[model samples]
Target: MPRRHRLTPEKHLKHAPWRFTATDKAVLTRLAQYRYLKSLTLQKLTGRPIATVNYSLRKLFDRRLIDKPHRQVEGFNHLNAPDIYEINARGRRWLTEEVPEVTTLSRTHTEGPPKHFAHSVAICDALAEIELEVATAGNAFIPAATILAKATVPNPLKMPCTIEHTFPNGKHERLETFIIPDGVYGVRYPDGRSELVFLEVERCNPRNPQTLFRASLLRKTLSYRALREAETARCLGKKSFGVRFIGLSDR
Candidate 1:
């Protein structure tokens, strides 16, 4: 068997222009939505075979439309971890120019992967799974961008409000907090009914004491309770909405 020569970005630039396919555009769109995604996640989101996803990713990388940071290799277990990719400036421009329907593009990660890369990856995994399940159930999963398009309030996702609590000490306490969800989406059923949902990804760290975790979660719960009481969704142009929490383990 003959060995295949791996082409670098420079070599690809010198070669003849490569045309875009449906799969290629789909991959780019996903990148634009998530900002950072693993190769396997792209496969799941696109519902394509591993070979097809890898080929598309390779071609995109070679053309400098996407970036696979070396920092990913340093952070994860290299033996089995999939490559992480992000859309570069060129890719963003390509999508804006070539795909007119793609109006929303995630902000570029100028500082590289976030401080909590695992948490981000877990969020993407959960989203991919939920999206697939929604499709299987014959429903449409509308992403945050779509939901925000019709929003009346500015920056509704990061909501800020005040909460008042009556403590056991017979005293009234007021706390001001922000309700920032990891993601917001909507599920539309066949009966012309739609439900809005806020997604929060929680990770359990073995190093942190359980008591602290519980306290943190309690605060979040209170914040969400306040949000519901205030009918934040209605303010955001929705009748009602639900909050979903996805728990992840450090292991």
Candidate 2:
């Protein structure tokens, strides 16, 4: 009797159930990472043609794989506005099975008004653009897909430092808690160097500049400095990470 040879997955590809194309899965993984995207944004992320992106999105929607989040902005035309979408429950489950590398994202919920929903998606879209820039520039980029949701600064053993805020009248109070940052990812330069970026995208549009000063940018900076200080003290000759900030204007 002749010995039997093992069959390969490609050899059995014709008999297998339909699966998303590599592009589709890549786009889905990004959707899973970002939690929301519009068709235009999806095209940007996937580097696919606009028509292809739109058609694939429609197919995903038809299959109940993604959800369209509604916005409450007045005079907001859904057609004109970028439609917000996320992997629905079914989509999540499918991705977990197909792409085990992705740790499932927590279902994004909205406690704010629908307008805030629009802002959230806009912020994500902006970050996606930065990632596109890095990729197009021939640098290595790591999307949030592989990044954990929360990261502790100065490691688990050390406590984050806080500064005191002194008022003009001489009343001084300790600054409030530090933030964990919006996201962190690695970027490798073509020169073979890489750094983990502390990512923050300001989605808030101030009706005035006062709103900007009111936010915690200064305090956030100081907090990060403290983390760097802690690292310096804790380790020797280690390079430090930097913050990359991006802000969008209402106009």
Candidate 3:
């Protein structure tokens, strides 16, 4: 396999100052939304060619507007995975200052890649695929932001519920837990009807013992069940909602 060309500050400076374009702004916006994304993912989200996306990323990196987490270098290089990028303070400031209309929340800036980097990336990939498909179907994809803006409940994403379970000794217990999903989105059909859905990405870990994994799954199932019984969808101004789990392999 051919080696990938590294972008150095010296090489970046040799060219004229990179002017921000629409595509560059789109890349920053996406970084703000996803927090961390792969170079290929950005290409798909921006609907730009890979070369163009790389060019924009390089320029943004040179300007200190975006970052490549050092942790990704070794693992991604070995696997030939696309480079992961994140927005930095400067990038968020640029979005707020230059593109006043763009929303740049404090969460946009991250210290580094998440502990579960692969899992996070999988969630982003699933959301992107769904968004693209919804657009293709001529339906409007309502993102979490819109849902939150219209929600009557505070922090609806992090729902709290009580779970009841029995021990081997036949003792019953009630535990308080939270049902936090990976994401929330809605699909507005052309017929003026909308469907709200919660997303959960589940990845099986071979290292985890089956018993432990099953217990974890059970807790999640119970949490969702509790939420359904409580009619938590009403908090979001909906009578009902659906939970979609995207199962992933350990690979």
Candidate 4:
């Protein structure tokens, strides 16, 4: 398969309202059957170039009518290639209610019946922009962190570090990697600087209320001692990071 493009962060606009076309619905239905199909394969099925396939998928994804499958495959360059397209319960219901012609196959239903599937789709669109932004930033590629800290003083880790937050729940969600937004200026320690000097400017606005709330609860519920102990045992897993919240009034 040809190299598929990675999405950037500017595209994660979940709070926005959008509409999907009939073509978007068709592409999604095809993807729902395969759970993951390459743009080339989609072209063969739809009789178009890989570009059209991606465009349709992007629209469907932006609309939240389909999701990328959670599985990975070996790529041409030995990287983890994405394959399959699985429609979640939300997508199924949307198809049934909004576009009922293709409900032949029964679909499973989840608790939050995705009344805002269209909204989630908008978020996915924003995430594509975010992914593209990160891919191009080239701000000192740092090794994936095993733990989070303010900053590493004395350069103990001896590895390059990046300052950014992360969102882990994309269509093909990856591991605990930071989702560094574009326009976030990063400063690095010179060869002789004592402290690890750095600066950052927030860019992407995170609008997912549930994830933000859950992360906050987790931080408070897990005490310092308990968190440390769990880290020592390698039992506590890292959740995705989000935009840092400064003081703001709920009005």
Best by lDDT: 3
Tens digits of per-residue lDDT for model 2, 1-251: 65422111123333345558766676678788777777788888788898878766765665666666644234347646666667767777777787998633222334333445655665567667778888888998765433333333324222256655555566655654545556556678988887666666665533232221255665666667777776632221224777787674433
**TM-score for each of the candidates:** 0.81, 0.70, 0.81, 0.33
**TM-score of candidate 3 relative to the true fold:** 0.81
**lDDT tens readout by residue for model 1, 1-251:** 65433323545362558888888998999888777788888898888899999999888887888887665665686557787887888898888887877634222245355776777766766776777789899999887677887878877677876766565566665677787777777899999999998887887633222332233555567778887878877756786788888884443
What is the clash count for each candidate, in the order shown? Answer: 0, 0, 0, 25
Candidate 3: residue 134 Cα off by (Å): 1.9
Q: Which sequence of candidate numbers ranks them by TM-score, best first?
A: 1, 3, 2, 4
The collision pairs in model 3 are none
Per-model RMSD to reference: 4.2, 10.9, 4.2, 19.1
Error of 3 at 29 (Å): 1.6
Task: Give the Å shift of residue 8 in candidate 4.
Answer: 8.3
Candidate 4 per-residue lDDT over residues 1-251, each given as its tens digit: 55434331124544466666666666666544333355545555555666767776766565556665322222232135433344666677777776655522112234343443433332332332332344455333121121222234432222222222234654221122122221111112344222111111222333342242232322222222232333321211222122322212331
**What RMSD value applies to candidate 3?**
4.2
User: At residue 93, what lDDT does model 4 achieve?
Assistant: 71
Q: Which is superior by lDDT, 2 or 3? A: 3
